[model samples]
Target: MFPSKDAPLKIGAFCSIAGQVRFMCSGQHPTDSATSFPIYSRLLKQPEPVANGGKPAGITVGNDVWIGNGAMILPGVEIGDGAVVGAGAVVTKNVPPYAVVGGSPARLIRYRFSEDVILQLLAIQWWRWDDEKIKREAAALTGPIETFIERHSVAGTATK
Candidate 1:
């Protein structure tokens, strides 16, 4: 994670970040500047960075996300829950929940599950469940999505 006083990298629970996975929160070149050079930062005499109206900032990774080896996540990119970032992917944009993204400036390859299932999981938000609840449903959590949803859905109310 690149250190930025202003921009922070917020990671959620159960993330599997692989080797060389970079969360670049800092090192943003002043693209709005005329020359795209940080004159103030480089030269003591120069004034502060030019007014770059829109600068990308921060990285947010949600729960159950798996970032593969050598993945580079750029500033202001948000990886949602259950998303899979492929190896060596350079993610420049926000990845949606349950998405499987790959390639340079990563594109959405697919979602891990169908829309209905994704919605069900989002609503259930099993990752946020208490320790006892998680332990009680360990088998279902590790098994199939259908089973998990069936057991934990609003109608089922497995928690109760």
Candidate 2:
């Protein structure tokens, strides 16, 4: 969360970020530069040279995202809704919605649900549900995805 007006870290509702998860997008040394050092920038008292061609960018973690402990989200990375970042993963790129990514330079491990179900869940958008409604649909919400989607989507209740 370095200070940069143009690079604002935005985390959406209901995200489960673990301890030491870093959302960094600014104050980085430029890899493209002759040296990955900011001594000149510091000596000159100027803006520190940054990655992404000196154009620092923001990071976005969407709703229901679960970022594990020690995961490092790099500059300009957009982690989509319902995605999971495994422990110690160094995410360097955009993660798709519902993607389960892990490892250095995070790779796609798997998706949380089938494509159709994911679309349905996205359409359901249960995170936006009111507290009372969520409490009322607790059983369905915590149950199997099929039952949850059936009761919520077809019956118009909610999804977990």
Candidate 3:
């Protein structure tokens, strides 16, 4: 529910947040010691001590990210730019840029493209472009990798 002031939740532009995705943002009950009832609720009841250091680190989702329906993003996960979180995925860690992840504790299934292409895309940073430019370059953005690269290539670029 709450995003930390220090690292507020950063959901980048053009990102698609699907329906029923849960962002767990606040204090979690202590698992080390067994409790009959939730301690966090008790803390909420009492404000004198102001217990449980408010909201942990915020989740950061980068530009062009696609979070699928019913995905549960736990606190402190950093989903990188252009990443795709599959439906019902429970993200528990940092997802690398352009990665496609899925499963209960989401694992990287694959990357959308080769490292070189990813690098090129990162460099292009199409998400940062102005609306007019983005519209003008829609074909390049949606085109094949080689075509896109050819359209916007820096001379002497080499791929591994």
Each prediction's whole-model lDDT (CA): 0.84, 0.83, 0.79
Report the C-alpha displacement of residue 50, candidate 3, in angstroms: 16
lDDT for each residue of candidate 2 in 26-87, tens digit (9 for 90 to 100) = 65677786776766447776655453346457888999999999999987799999999999
For model 2, name the residue pairs that clash.
Answer: none
Best model number under TM-score: 1
- For model 2, the superposed segments whose C-alpha errors exceed 4 Å read 35-52, 154-160
Whichever of 1 and 3 has more lDDT, that candidate is 1
- Taking all chains together, the TM-score of candidate 1 against the true structure is 0.86
Model 2: lDDT to the true structure: 0.83
lDDT of 2 at 78: 93
Q: TM-score each candidate.
A: 0.86, 0.83, 0.81
- Model 1 ranges with Cα > 4 A deviation: 40-54, 155-160
Candidates' RMSD to native:
4.1, 4.1, 4.0
lDDT of 1 by residue, 1-160 (tens): 7645567899999899999998887556776556666555467543343254335677999999999999999987899999999999999999999999999979999999988888788888888989998899899999988898888776543232
